[model samples]
Target: MRKFISRAAALLLAGVMTAAVAGCGKNSDSEAKDTAKKWTELDQTQITEAMGLGWNLGNQLEASSGGLPSETCWGNPEITKELIDTIKAQGFKTVRIPVSYLDMIGDGPDYKIDTDWLDRVQEVVDYVVNNDMFAIVNMHGDGYYTVDHSWLLCAEDDDKQTEIKDKYGKVWTQIADRFKDYDQHLIFESMNEEFNNDYGKPDEKAYDNINAYNQIFVDSVRATGSNNEKRWLLLPGWNTNIEYTAGDDYNFKIPTDKGCKADGKRIMISVHYYDPFNFTIDENKTAKTQWGKYAVKNYDNWGQEDYVDSQMALLNEKFVSQGYPVVIGEFGAQDKTEKFADYNEFRRYWSEYLIKAAKKNGVVCVYWDNGYNGNKGFGIINRFDYTITQPDLIAGMMRAINSTDDYEIPSPAGYTEVRKSAKAS
Candidate 1:
């Protein structure tokens, strides 16, 4: 029988599973764990600073069709160590690998993840970690309503809570154990962009369920012991929206980590930035192509430089200032070169300024690359040949990452004071 199955039976018979045995797995590689933890005796700030700029291995491992996941399902080639090697060479110290189990997970109490799929994911993570880069593994598309067999639903009926929570615990239990021996370089993020589908005021019950999911994620991973006990975890708020996460209207709770010897010093808050969707993802509406304060035409009056400043500042005040580091897990604008003549220039400018803003506020930013190049895509490098498709854009971003001087945004063409009301606070 699987370890989780026996543990579940025991929990039912004993009425509860104690915290002491949550990480009741084997630690065959204790020596490695000790060495990895000892390699860096730094707090969250120093650790995050060491991470530098991050990039997402997006639309590949997270790709699914009819609920079945395949790395090539989304038209991207199989993930190669060479691809990660090139990424590391490009000055990215961290790689965020978004994943989804969906049909890859089994039914019932244990909810065993498919060994083949899990192993493949591990192989990719090793490619990054072995390259001396931080690897962030996360539960990616399991919560999306569009994905088939996605049971990690926060908006489901209350009667389904037991099954949902059980599966959640079992999934993370298996994942944590699989990578329990890994060092601090392997970070496990709770979930990606999860929340009630409602874009308006979030549902209270759904938000509460998200909190429960995060708590369960932390508890399950820590229970697995080994390096997981001290591993840095990335937790996302509702939809990973800056306003919803940090604003006073919605309550986003950080999970309690009694398992960590250093209180919650190992935890990091995650949020995404794609403000002014009109210019970021909405490629069909090409009128809002230009961005930043210096755009002469086709620009959004809101979500400009000031908007980015306000959002990053909110995260710094709420979390970063209080010990928890913030990660902008995914942020990038789609290619609009076909629509606008100098779209690439504006896009490069957007990335440069955003990196500077994140650096200014002491937040880590990861570019979202969906692995597709050309118009209407968020890709920066071609996954097939492992070449940098956006040379100027990537170069400017790297400069911003390493530069010591503050990158100041020039004032708008006709503006004096800032537009506070339109900003996303």
Candidate 2:
């Protein structure tokens, strides 16, 4: 859910939109009847298994400098039916669409969402649903939910909590209403990774607020109509971190929806994985650039297969086994430094191992692709032409889910040859 935009550009956009009203203009008067057929009611586990291999339409709708800019502002092509069709062709069964409603929403009590933005979002969603793929639409990066401006941060202040709850409720109410007609193919994610406190550590009160917000989301959506009553909803853990979320200390609780007549059968927990940050995200060369059995130098000491197994095990034991499912909504290792001889090979291994481990534990895995194809970005596909730019990585993912065999640890040819030559010298 993260993207880069220069400070100057953000300031300029804010200044331009300052004179305009905050809402997305006005809600449309045309109340389209629910023509879409409702999907068969399935529990969380069935939904997760059916979701198969998933990919994120990242850095597009979620890309906003300040105001709601075009999806192309981040240099990604406008999302089209073909793009989703290509994804389906590539063996993906689910698409996670990340969106930001910060600029698209008005101020205060109503916090009205712009109808134009809603229409735009729905149009993109239709492309996914029409193709017979599961689609997830989430509240991506928004300033109001951050640590500095977060309403969830003020745990001691009751009045502040009420105000935050009110605004949060309004936002979801509008969103739920807009997508109410869509069947189970379209899922609503409560929010992206937004949990943070002033102290930068887990706060009990902040966690409480998060639970409240999730409850509000569930309640609001279900009240819209029966279409949403059984809709599969994804709720994220604090910061969407696996350890923090599944940890014994976090006191994470799934919100109960009195309106949901099925008794919380459709709710699923979401947690992200970018474990061994040194290898997955760190830009420094001092960190591990190589991993797996063939890793020549600076191999990651942590985040090996066992690490993945342990985390997945925790989720399965805590949630999945109990009937609630889990989704690894965002997980990827960046190809920031391609100069390494076995970079692509290492990426393939990483992708295969993660997917294999996730599925083994009955968790749905979704890879995060932000559409930046060079250094410091996780771009696998050339979104402009709808082509697979990283075939090895894509192939590895396909092999992992399709193959019945467990993922074998890879030994890169370059790494082995380099070691052999050095020993001979």
Candidate 3:
């Protein structure tokens, strides 16, 4: 009985000690988490910087383990014959795959992303580099993930932010190891659209976050122990908007790490153009409203050559002049146009303007054409028949890429209603 009593007393003492330590470590209501914890992926720095010919294939968002090929949505994969033929067939030598990695990884700080998901994503990237194309992959629409993590940057407690940094490290480690052996053509963008304005911190704080995030990304991918050491890296300015990075009001300081400076501008500053802005990006994404973006039958003096050129001039100054190649990573029309003729006409015009502007200013242009689930142009190829829309454009792109000289660029008005009507079905 006496021995039992002594054991009970020891157990009570141990409980008391545990509670004290936990209490001492407790964060104050106003204290934020810290970034003090270190991980290997947060330390390495293997990178490639260069002027790259690239395009972003939109609506290709996916979970880690790739899916069975959506007609226009994420998954499916970018390696099918149709995709390869279309991409390689075009003059494009590089492809940017923007992916959302949330569902694939749990919300936990040390979540282990599913390996199968990682493998599938890698396979598509392999196909791109293998074909002699520079492949740019990035964290797509991940703003949602960070938004939920506001505590990391906005919480009253510093300790929470540190924990958030820990989460970032864990996520990148999984990404880096997956594509470690890929070629230099395979570049990893740190993140897509670092938009967190609610933190109430100065814009500089956001910039600092970008630097820290890129460091983790570079360090994580380099740990894969292969050619990733020299693989190209892309740094986005704010939200990948041309106006944001290239406008007079926008001035983003580029980031460098571990004695590395920004690569004589090899880092491509990505931008998305859907000019006459409202027509292009309405949050109300319905087929009818989507078509509205292309319904402009009248362009007053503002849509004239001078005005368009003026806008593009800003882009050139901000990016091209900086010696860094820029890419219109995405641009496309939603199906808001009431008439198919309007759709085709607007498409043709938009395509012509965007393409020439890109070429003229020495930027690469890629359309965001994902018309999945009955939407238009999600996938260039008709999944059932395996045929492609805009065959002429793809064909022309190839010719341009291979030709010794520049081709005569066409205007949007020239395509006419016949082609639109013919291809309408």
Ranking by TM-score: 1, 2, 3
Residue 198's C-alpha lDDT in candidate 3? 43
Superposed Cα RMSD, model 1: 10.1
- For model 3, where is the 10-residue window of minimal lDDT? 35-44
Instruction: Decide which is better by TM-score, 2 or 3.
Output: 2
> What TM-score fits each model?
0.88, 0.86, 0.67
Tens digit of per-residue lDDT, candidate 2, span 291-410: 655566777766766688799899999889988889988888777555565666877777788888888888999888877666556778877787788887888898888877554644
Worst lDDT run of 10 residues, candidate 2, spans: 1-10
| Candidate 3, superposed: residue stretches over 4 Å from native | 1-55, 61-82, 106-109, 145-160, 197-208, 222-225, 248-251, 259-266, 278-296, 300-308, 335-340, 371-378, 392-408, 413-425
Report the C-alpha lDDT of model 1 over 204-247, residue by residue, as the tens digit.
88999999999999999989887778788999888888888899
Highest lDDT among the candidates is held by which one? 1
Better of 1 and 2 by lDDT: 1
Which candidate leads the pack in TM-score?
Answer: 1
